[model samples]
Target: MQVEIGSNFWTYSLCEGRERKLWWESEEYSKIFLKSGRNAFKAICNYISADKRKVLFPAYHCGTESEPWYESDWEVEYYPIENNFTVDANKLKQCIIKAKPAVLVIQSYYGFDALNDECNALLQECRNKGIIIIEDITQSILSDIRHQAVDYYIASLRKFFAIPDGGVLISRQPIAIRKIAQGDNNIPLNAMQAYSLKREYFETKNKGIKEEFRAAYVVLNELISVNDNNYAMSDVSLKIWNSFDFTYIAQKRRENYRTLSEGLAKIDYLAITRTFDNDTTVPLFLPVLVKNNTLRQELQAFLAEKDIYCPIIWKKSPRIVDCPKETSAIYERILCFPIDQRYDKEDMLRIFNTVEKWNV
Candidate 1:
């Protein structure tokens, strides 16, 4: 299948879905606002001080996710995540007590997975200690299982839908949210253009098209750092969010993930890290780690030649974030293959064939 940074491009049908009201801002729940995930993180960090700037996050993450903490003058530290992307509770507790960050950020990678009992215990301990918890569900936004007792929730909805730049932030407590109004329409404009360019590149493989796509990406990347963006999702983002049925999207993703997981599990070349255990968990992607780093790079390049783009999940952070050896190894070896609802079983088989034919 054709892929770009993530999955399939937005179609006109996506623009035609019905509107879904904002459900997270009610009394029983928290106040949910829309922005970029990094911007959302920045808004929360505004409430804490330099001493409390210590934010304990998972070892595996993108630089942008951690940049808010760094910019806030927080002592950003990382706790270990297992090879399977599961939290190591005992290790996490140790890091928490040692670092004593003002805030703790936990990511439910790829949406459907939940925290283990021991990890839950650690979450309780953090809460008891009065640590501000920020649960990032950018991947798990629509998962049936959710994090409880968290002070704040953050997610990048733009990843799930064809939205033009949107992130959701929820504050369980009645704290007045903060933001700076941006009159510029550059962010959404760039976002829309970026999507169009990628879809075009996918359709027409002109060599220079990628350069144009990269230019659009650079603009989108620059837009994310905006400090003062007013409340709510963009007017356009709300329309895109409203036009779709989440249940259908979630189910389709599950079907695609399960199909790929079963077929890939039989192969011996690499270790599959994520498996769809049931219907409730919707995977953002199918994660696999090649045993050899060199072969992994080669396999990725081979796929790219055929227009099957795979995400490396993330590269090692240039800033050393005190990660474990296992976590570091994982960053270097894993591949995040797109298994969203964009394609069917036959499409997955095509991906499997590419890997199967790789000369590892």
Candidate 2:
């Protein structure tokens, strides 16, 4: 079941047809702001109380994933999550009391779990202190859209769909936002380029198409690197996003995750960072932390030879790479397996069996 490189990145295939539900959350979210999820974080930061400049971020995270925290001009502060990515309420409360900061960003790692009870209580503490809560669900958009008590929610819809440009900002209550209209060649042009590269590879089975795709993305990313990231999603990207069936997307991802997670569980060397019950949490990917960076490289190479490629979660951010002793130990070791809707049970089994076979 091997295919072209970059074809199976976290989300499902956009070129194929599948069952879909025409679902929109206009009512649930006061206003649905369409943009890249990365920009949504910046927008949320802008909307928060102007007085609070310092925001607490989790220690275990990808550097770029939290770029909005920096872009919003807030003094970003770090807090620690356990090896499993769960926050301790007591420790978090202490940080809040010490920082007495304005905002708290809570992330649902891999979108397969919810905030722990202690963190839930701490969330109330933030409310009591009039602290703004920005929930980062870019990886777990469907799990919890609007927190009843949270001020704002942001998710990267592009990750879940084939659309090139998409990030959504949901206000529990409607608020005014000044942003630019998003008719950009960067996202749409780059996104469609991805589609074309994928299509060409599928049809022609040519590796040459990837260079064209890579060049497009290079230009697209360069544009993104310079923009303020306060624009809305493009019309073409939005149309592509709306055509998908939400029900099918979620169900397929859950089924694939269960098959892979169950199989991974049997191999104790690879530790699953989080686990969900009754499939309540629809995962973005099945994340596992190998024992060390050396082992990680070996495993990645081994998997690639078997036609399975897992990406390092993100290039670890230098700021948090060393301080959070735990994060430093395994940041390079984290690898994510694609468990999206595109693959079926057989696919999941192949992935699992390959990893298991590697262990043997």
Task: Please provide, for model 1 over 252-340, each residue's C-alpha lDDT reduced to its tens digit, 9 standing for 90 to 100.
Answer: 78887887788778778679876666677877888888777887898888888877888788888888646698788788789878777
Q: Report the CA-based lDDT of candidate 1 relative to the real structure.
A: 0.74
> Which prediction has the highest TM-score against the true structure?
1
Candidate 2: which stretches are off by over 4 Å? 2-24, 32-34, 144-146
lDDT of each: 0.74, 0.70
Task: Provide the lowest-lDDT 10-residue window in model 1.
Answer: 4-13
Per-residue CA lDDT of model 2 for 57-81, tens digit only, reads 8777666557767776788877776
- Model 1 residue runs over 4 Å out of place are 1-8, 12-27, 49-51, 197-214, 225-232
Number of clashing residue pairs, candidate 1: 6
Q: What's the CA error at residue 7 for candidate 2, in Å? A: 4.9
RMSD, one per candidate, in order:
2.8, 3.3
Ten contiguous residues with the weakest lDDT in model 2: 4-13
Error of 1 at 357 (Å): 2.0
